[model samples]
Target chain A: MSAPPLPRTSAEPLVPVLAIVGVGLIGGSFAAAVRQSGLVTRIVGAGRQGGTLARAQALGLIDEIVSLQQAAQTADLILIAAPVGATTEILATLQPSLRPETIVTDAGSTKADVVTAARQVLGDQVGQFIPGHPIAGAEATGPEAADAQLFQGRSVVLTPLAENSNASKALLTRLWEACGARVVCMEPDTHDTVLASVSHVPHLLSSIYMWQVATAQDSDLRMALAGTGFRDFTRISAGSAEVWRDIFLSNRPAVLAELQEVKAALARAEQALIDGDGAALEDFLERAALARRLWGSRSGLA
Target chain B: MSAPPLPRTSAEPLVPVLAIVGVGLIGGSFAAAVRQSGLVTRIVGAGRQGGTLARAQALGLIDEIVSLQQAAQTADLILIAAPVGATTEILATLQPSLRPETIVTDAGSTKADVVTAARQVLGDQVGQFIPGHPIAGAEATGPEAADAQLFQGRSVVLTPLAENSNASKALLTRLWEACGARVVCMEPDTHDTVLASVSHVPHLLSSIYMWQVATAQDSDLRMALAGTGFRDFTRISAGSAEVWRDIFLSNRPAVLAELQEVKAALARAEQALIDGDGAALEDFLERAALARRLWGSRSGLA
Candidate 1:
């Protein structure tokens, strides 16, 4: 584990002081990725509880464990990789020491909320903040689960405010690319809506389905019979409850809209079943299958 | 493919004669499984379409492609692996030549429909029919996609009618086991309900979600950005539209009921999002995640 031999040369200018807030899976991963890339000269991580910081540093996820104020004061980039709900307080803590040149970005799921929180804490200086979400993670959590390769082949969505400097945006984009992510620029609200449909709502659906199965009278038998299909359908349900709960709350509207649309489709199929409308049910299934096939084929997922 | 080298000993006897009635993915796989298990002396396939029969024979998916009457006349087991809607008609065509010892089963997704269809066509001889579903398949279709190992490590749910003999039940169970499936017994209604909740509803939800995305203004962009999360969530949507449509129709009530429940949950999430209730959203996501994690872990998926 002594740093799997560097995969690439360290040609880029060294990031002198890098601060990662809430060093769990995402934060830890960012730290590891920076280390792997050989682009950061020094990395410091700040966590609410000292234990996480200690563990992160011990695991080589960070070079130093420091206070939020200390990390904020010295770091070139202060990355808020905490749960969406925790961003506001973390931003507040970093405000006094916020340097004009310090690029503040986040790896939160929801963008608008993080942007709003940054605006409230740092006002016009929010221009230094780039609201970004790296669409990558495992069902597992904590620094132990962090892998430098987590973001590889993944997409990172960046929501840059109008006032954000081109240099800041370019740097952040390059960093993500260096981490092996395909970067896409999106409007903050649009990103939330799209993500809710694609990620958050699906998580909720998986959880509800699992709950239904768990509550069944023959839960043990059902659980034993659960195979790859069930596993795949429920993978997202294994995500951190605390983090997901916050995400659901923060991005409820889009999730709900997507849920409603799915429900209507389900209801239509239900009516067909009750009425013994084989043709109608087939039609619905066909449409669904077609859409999925097209999307999957187009996405190189088929 | 020179019969793909049968996996079982040739010495095993009273080898059943299996008449596979579709010779596509399910039927072809069954034919291959029968050959691989050395549990069937002959795997004769009956398909109305000439191309399927040709492909099945050419791919060594079947020993012979026979007419429905001929297959029913000589086979010890009649596996109606055709579309659910076509099962009754196929049963009717095969009934005239069905022997008293012939054990008929199916690979239908929905049991209740197939059972009902069997009762209509076979009457008192319905006792000879055993409704079964192998919860195994890939997105790929046709004889070319059939694999003898498809059922390996998969579950095969059997719903024997009240009148079915223990001998027939045991034989059907053995056949599935020979195909490398772990067999489970359940009442037909219960099987339909369980599958609807776990499998059917998920497919419908995936399709609806895919439809939403596919129909979006930036569908290409969305599709391009689609990652493993979307791919997994919508995997079932890439399945055969015709086959899935029939399943939806056949098991509409249970699927609809499940859909209603999911819809309610999704609607709640939507309301929370609109109301900007981060706590509520978080709670929902956490609950879902916990349920999924518990089920997934218990199922050996996590």
Candidate 2:
């Protein structure tokens, strides 16, 4: 545990012994990817679900399953790879046992809340926390869905604290790059705002749309007629409620702002339809279609 | 064309020659599938875009490209494959030259309005018009996107007129079956209502979400970080504006009803978030996840 923290590059053993606080898809995938890259010598997973922890170890996503206390005290690096809402409690539990040189980071969807939780729980040791959000996941969940290439070419955003040492930030960046991700730095507020607009709003809307279809009086008939369009549009509606509930509540303000924006835009289309304004509706649709196609082609998607 | 003139089922040349008015993805795919099945001797395409019509012929989706007038005058079956809003005008122009043995049908997304258009333009000839919705399409369009197997194993809902002779209905059913579709009969109004809840609403919501993202102040950054979730959620927003505008206008009342239903469902989630009710939000999310997962497996999509 030197002051400069080894070499902070690919030459260094970034995670010689790493500890992951949650053994779900995100945590397991992080463990799998870093281990595959030879950046981590061993990965210890700790979670409330002992069965899942054991399974993750069996699947080679982790080297061993340990208790939270043991994970907090021994690892060279700590990853709080749990839900955003769980940040506070986990940080509080680990507060008494944390070693200063052990770089602590997280893979939570919401950043501002995680920052607040770190400040409250870690006290003066908050500098150890460099909050991160990897914009990658599947509809599937758990350690069983973990993939070694999950982070390849994907974007991972890091919100660093002013108290965070330059060596620590650079080490985190190199570690993520070794895992095959493109790392970008941002303010926690900026991360939360952008994510709410692009990710959280779409997820909530998809769920709402699915609930509407499934609860309608003639729901069975309606679903029977649904096609590829409906399936793709509402695919995220199948994501885990346990994970999404925390994301929504933790990022409530930014999410609410984006939701309001969606409602206003939708109202314009609804108004155009009610008034039989074909021209207005067409213009609205044309603008959206053009934007989406431009982005789709730029992003190399069909 | 003629009052119960042609014999129904595959007993006769169900479609010795067929005319498709739009000749885009839907129309071209219909022609391609039927032609592959040997149910039609020749497929004639009519559209404002001569280039696309020519391309359809070159792709073998259509056997010939002709003027709307020529197609209306010569074909034994006139498939009004244009937009729903174009149905009335097309029928009005075709009414003067239709042969008595010709049986007319359409592939419009909305049934009730197409039935209205047929009634208004075809007069007593409306009995020959059977409205159909294929319930299959992709984000891509044009002749290049047309697939012969587009309708295979997919449901095709037919809303037949009271005036439809047993022969005409039987013939239409047999033709779709030939193209490998499972055809189900329904009332036009019922078809519209069911489609509104399952299909139309999802498309509109996706557009709204995309528009929301594209219009946000930091839209470029947000979209840059968008992952598979946003891509899947907004897939349908890339559909043709010109085509969707007509469907939205023609199916106004039903789409609006479903849109309202979505708003109500969304409001409940919004309330749960505002009240900081994790249990309520979790419950709301659980129902949608279960419903979507069930449907996904049933439909062979994950």
Candidate 3:
């Protein structure tokens, strides 16, 4: 179900020097897990000018914080875990210092945009850039929230370009597996479309709904009356604004397309209510209830 | 703060006999809590012809399973926790046997429709019926999911009729307080409108999104890739289908009104994406993120 098993020999680290850019939740957690697995000799973290990189170092999530160029020069593997919007700039910065053998991967939510950015900047060196997305996230952020078990039993999607060699793909796949993730391969466009339907659109719609309710005239009263359901439904809206903003913009095409479908679905529901069609309404709700219940049971998230 | 501090006297049970019309999550929890509080001598349950009433009795949440008429004839208070669609029929059955002093209340999600149904069926006895919406819920249902502390530290909103005496209002307030819930009062229309903004619309929208995705051509792939955000956002869709169906229909006007506003918000977001207006998109998301984070922190739900 996953890539070939990690090619390991006795007592050898999988990565000699690992570099993580944007040491936030995903990056920090990857460092923690890989370190815990004893699969990396050293972890260097680079992030936007802030205490996050220092915090990651302090929390033992990384060996040190360095400049992007320094990280690229010294690293055997560089993982860009920043927001998708910053991908092109980060790639451009890394291109000059990047060694031919140093493989690069990312943890962005959108794949196609990141792939395009990598191709535009890396050019002939793009073969070393393998795109990835960890299908794991939480509302929490920063180094403090990173856990060694963050990616345990989770799926990590790798959308490798045609230029990539099997060895480069296998290395990243092995790294993700070492962090306890199941690696799956997908086409970049399909990955973007699928993720847009399930993740990007849900995030945007949740934020839209939250914004509407929070800015309404009776917002105070409405907030006071909201309960567990409202809390859970809007929980994702509390995520990092810059990160999600980048996601929605990067995956705009698929997201806008799915939003049309969601709008159509809402219109049908509204029509059922306006027509007072109890049978139609009940049938609709029942289908949703059944599907949701089945998924919850199967996913163990009920 | 909570109805004259429960109007208590030392060592005396607040209610002698309590009747729960539907032995589901809300009603069964209420029975369990009141029984544990020693505020009731007996708890009788009546539900749609099924194993639910018997199951509630077996779980010690109810002392007996009886007909609605029997419950009306003997109980000091009757709580109709059935779906709103069943409220009228249940009220009609209880009206003939309802004692003048037997106060009636409900745990429906919508208040205005429940109020109208009570007025239609209970007629002159409408004074006995108090409309309420509990600001607590879980995806689980039935007696098995009932917890005595389900309402603890939760808000229970009551929309009292003009016909209701101070004594009747005070009794329901005291009952909810005994179950560790803070009781608040609102006009029937106001309660419906507020809940429409927070709870009802979210549930309907979540269900519609879930339904659309679950029925899509690549639903299996989408579901496979979905993570925690999707789970939390759509958890409410797994609720009782009949219950939510009735909630949407019963609260049609308010839900429809809220849906219009939600559509407008979504349209704005769609336009922002189309124009690639990063500033506008980020601004919209930032506002929602701020509001959601504030609410989550203040509500201790973060």
Candidate 4:
């Protein structure tokens, strides 16, 4: 049985100044939840768009807007919540201003790239960085879509750097716990492969299927006839294009591998249909239906 | 703006006797809805399993259990809600017993085959048959899973035969409208092609994706980390294997045609990923996202 979410604790904040970079859905939601829990004294948000950063502050997702360097200098903990492709540059800019005792973590969906970025930019201060990917979010984006309960009953995976200590890992774990997330620790590469099969490839395939149907000659008629099942099956394709594009590029190898596997499976299914092999096709669908039926309960998503 | 669901016209019934061929999700729900609308004096259910039929009667989904011939002799309206492949045989047996004026309709997912079966089995009385596909269902099946409101606000597509009179079409349309469905009439081939693109291919793709993920060595870990989006995207894959197999096999040509279209799109997306062409990938995803975002509002599913 699963344990209860959120442990009892005092009202003391986790860090004096918590800085968030790229204040979009992930960063904004993290700020809202941590701020609601009073686990940080101030949330300083930094982003490429000055307007978006200011709006994040106005929405109370952040206490102020600042430059990446300024945030690195003042904050005790820095959260990089940018897309995976931008993390390398963000970490590079923040490296020069970081103090040795300060902790840094990121919320990118693809983690191996973030680890490589840390290795290149943070220099010897890489020990302070803990790479993570929160298994949460919807197709919606921005500060306006932020919710304090976004991470409740969700899992956050942390992939600590070789330079990290046990105390730093504990501190980061506690921080996520305060936000009501069940934290798991795994190697960055393992996280990438697992997520490729479970999330990234699914997103790509859904988008691909949607593109196939949407650009077809009878798309208007097809769309009219589509019901809730079709809607649910392809809803993830509506996610932010830039974010998904980055994920596809950053996690290309694993995504490509899984796509090949699916292509092979679909070929067999198509052949079974052409051959009029009802028994063979039923066998194929049987395995999937049984597996998927058993998945909902064990899959925390339910 | 749409009007309220059911009219408050009369305690009078719509049909004196309504017969359901298979007392499952679609047929049982039809029984419940029409009965609640006070639109049927007697509901007769016929299936292979006497035990299941008894349960349906206990649940009030049917007022009596009868043989197909008996139902044909008495019921003014006979609803063939069995699986698609079985409908041909069912219609053949019911034809000899069916009264000349009796109206016969079906609730199959695939229609071209049903139209052909009606043409072959019901002979000159084929004019009484209306081939239909209700764009509503849940992951659940069986009589116990039936709901009176299943068809409310949903679309019901009817593909009538050339022999069908205006009166026959109007009667089927009115019966569905009274059950709160928005009815649309089109050619049988048009219905099959639209459904092949919208429903059949999505179900097949989802099952293949699930099979791909579940058969992997790291399936346990992948399932653990999967989120609600994954669940919703793959939910249809959990539907009955026999039902889906019949759908794929019965609608092979159109399903294969659509699958080829999807394969081409997937290959294109994969190429963009391999080329690291962010702009191309973004363009591909942008079209899908825009189409899907707009689909929910126009789609009855939303």
What TM-score does each prediction get for chain A alone? Answer: 0.92, 0.95, 0.97, 0.95
| Per-candidate alpha-carbon RMSD to the true structure | 5.1, 3.1, 1.4, 3.0
lDDT tens digits by residue: candidate 3, B1-302 = 23544536626876789999999999989998888877788899987856998888889998889998899999999999998889989999999999999999999988887888899998999999988877888989888999999999889999999998887788788888888988999898999999889999999989999999999999999988888899989999999889998998989999999989998999898999999999999998999999999999887656
User: For each prediction, how big is the interface RMSD?
Assistant: 2.6, 0.9, 0.8, 1.0
Expressed as tens digits, the lDDT of each residue in A11-71 for candidate 3 is 6887899999999899999999998877799999997856898888989999988999999
Runs with alpha carbons beyond 4 Å of true place in candidate 3: A1-10, B1-10
TM-score of each: 0.90, 0.95, 0.98, 0.96
Of the candidates numbered 1 and 4, which has the greater TM-score value? Answer: 4
Error of 4 at B251 (Å): 0.4
**What does candidate 2's lDDT look like per residue over B1-302, in tens digits?**
11244444444466889999888888988888888766688888887889999888888888788887888789988887777888888888888888777888888999988888789888888887788889889989898999888898889999888888788787788778778888988888999988888888888888877887888788889878988899999889999998889989888899998788888888999999999999999998999999999999998645
| Predicted candidate 4 versus true structure: per-residue lDDT over A182-279, tens digit per residue | 99889988999999888998899889989888989888889888887898889899899988988988988888888889889988988899999999
Best by DockQ: 3
For residue A177, model 2's alpha carbon misses the true position, in angstroms, by 1.5
Using lDDT as the measure, what is the rank order of every candidate, best first? Answer: 3, 4, 2, 1
Give the lowest summed-lDDT range of ten residues in model 2 chain B.
Answer: B1-10
Off by over 4 Å in 4: A1-8, B1-9
Show model 2 residue runs off by greater than 4 Å.
A1-12, B1-13
Alpha-carbon shift of residue B238 in model 1 (angstroms): 1.4
Identify the leading candidate in terms of TM-score: 3
Scoring the B chain of model 1 against the true B chain gives a TM-score of 0.92
